[model samples]
Target: MLAALRVGPRRRRRLRAAIGGISDKVLTDCLHRLLASGLIERHAHAGAPPRVDYALTGSGQSLIDGPMTALGRWAVEHGDELLEAQESSSAKGL
Candidate 1:
């Protein structure tokens, strides 16, 4: 979610599209959590239909730049090994 917000602010629909397979409830829950944590800001635009946009806060950006980047790198480096382990475990279970 933070990674997706890295680009810029996005509306709910855009976010849902970017993060495929996430249910509306899950996305709303996540957005509320992020809002509560001060990691993201919600903007309300006054219009006939109204508009809302979610953008990363400074803390959120820092998180993405630091820990998230490292985590992504770690996943890239160990993904194959992790997949193999999962497959092996599943084979054993069967």
Candidate 2:
């Protein structure tokens, strides 16, 4: 989700499309959490209908460039091994 926002600010619909398959409840929860933590900022537009946009803060960018980058590298290196283990466990019915 943070990766999706790394590009720039996005509306709710755009976010949904960018990070597909997440439930509404989960998405809302995550957004609220990020907002509360000051990792992201939500802006509201003034109009007949309300509109909101979300963008990452400096802290969020740090998180993405630092730990998230490392985590992504780790995943790329070990994802196949993890998948094989999961398959093996399933085969053993465990």
Candidate 3:
């Protein structure tokens, strides 16, 4: 879905390629869940080639806005600790 947005909305097949091709079945299930929760909309208009686009709804964007801000603040505050953990975890594998 993130990659799909990067394309500014696109068909399922294009989104699949962008994100490394999860199976169509999984994609279908995910879309259904998102639509049910009102996070995204399945867009269709009078056109040829049967195009469908998915875009995040207003509420969905609002939901992410809050968490994204919090995540940014947390990363700023804990970045050093996170990096140290990553370095130690890598060293232990040697």
Off by over 4 Å in 2: 91-94
Cα-based TM-score, every candidate: 0.89, 0.83, 0.65
How many residue pairs clash (N, CA or C atoms closer than 3 angstroms) in each of the candidate models, in the order given? Answer: 0, 0, 0
Among these predictions, the greatest lDDT belongs to 1
Q: 2 or 3, which is superior by lDDT?
A: 2
Tell me which of candidates 1 and 3 scores higher on TM-score: 1
Q: Estimate, for each residue in 1-94, the C-alpha lDDT of model 2 and write its tens digit.
A: 8899999999998998999999889999999999999899999998979899999999999999999999999999999999999999999999
Which is better, 1 or 3, measured by lDDT? 1
Please tell me which predicted candidate would have the highest TM-score against the true structure.
Answer: 1
Error of 1 at 34 (Å): 0.6
Rank list by TM-score: 1, 2, 3
lDDT of residue 54 for candidate 3? 82
Q: Please give the ranking of all candidate structures by lDDT, highest first, separated by commas.
A: 1, 2, 3
Tens digits of per-residue lDDT, candidate 3, 14-79, equal 777776758889888988998899978889866676678887787667656677658878999999
